[model samples]
Target: MSLTSVFNIAGTGMSAQSTRLNTISSNIANAETVSSSIDQTYRARHPVFATVFQNAQGGNNGSLFADKDQSGAGVQVMGIVEDQSSLMARYEPNHPAANEAGYVYYPNVNVVEEMADMISASRAFQTNVEMMNTAKQMMQRVLTLGQ
Candidate 1:
């Protein structure tokens, strides 16, 4: 793969990680949100990502794996999916959002898990930035070869 491709791949990675971080932040922010009903409760959201690959002819074949004739393009955000797990129900009858059954529904978001995911996404973004910088440095060094 060419050094220029590295920049594109890393850029895509950074974008994907940014989306992930956004979802993580949203989950954390809504972790304490209360609702009178389960249907109105905020569910934890997570981003789904997929790898992009290009064939030898530079066309995407939608293949999951890159063979000898294929190269990895980068990561793509598939979509944001809500956690299917059960939401938290508390017996807070005095709460403003309490249901008729004296139970308040909270988001399924786990603050600790969200924090860990945030850190991981941040690291991934930083790694992508470092990769782009390294690619730039390599290109700069190649230019100095003729000096």
Candidate 2:
């Protein structure tokens, strides 16, 4: 891989991590939200990521389906998916948002897990930033090779 491609790889990594962090924050924010109906409850959201690959042989290896010619390029966020787990139902008859059966539905978001994911995403983003900065320094030093 070329030195310039490092920038693209790191940029994509940062972008993916940013998306992950956003979803984690959203999930954490809605962790305590309560609703009368299950449908109205906020569901924990998670981002889906996929690795992007590029064909090294001019984008194709002269075959209809070429896997050997592909190389890892960067990461990409595919989409956001909601948690399928059941929502927390509390028998809080005194709550304002309680249902007719005296049950309040809370979101499926787990604050502890969300916080851990946030920390991981933050570190990944910082790592990507460091990688980009290192690439920039390397490129700059190459310019001083003749001096």
lDDT of each: 0.89, 0.89
The sequence of per-residue lDDT tens digits that candidate 1 reaches over residues 1-147 is: 678989989999999999999999889888888999989999999999988876634765554554545677898999999999999899999998898899999999989889999999999999999999999999999999999
Number of clashes recorded per candidate? 0, 0
Q: In model 2, which runs have C-alpha deviations exceeding 4 angstroms? A: 56-69
Report lDDT (Cα) of residue 70, candidate 2.
65
The TM-score obtained by model 1 is 0.91
The candidate scoring highest on TM-score is: 1
Residue 133, candidate 1: Cα error in Å is 0.4
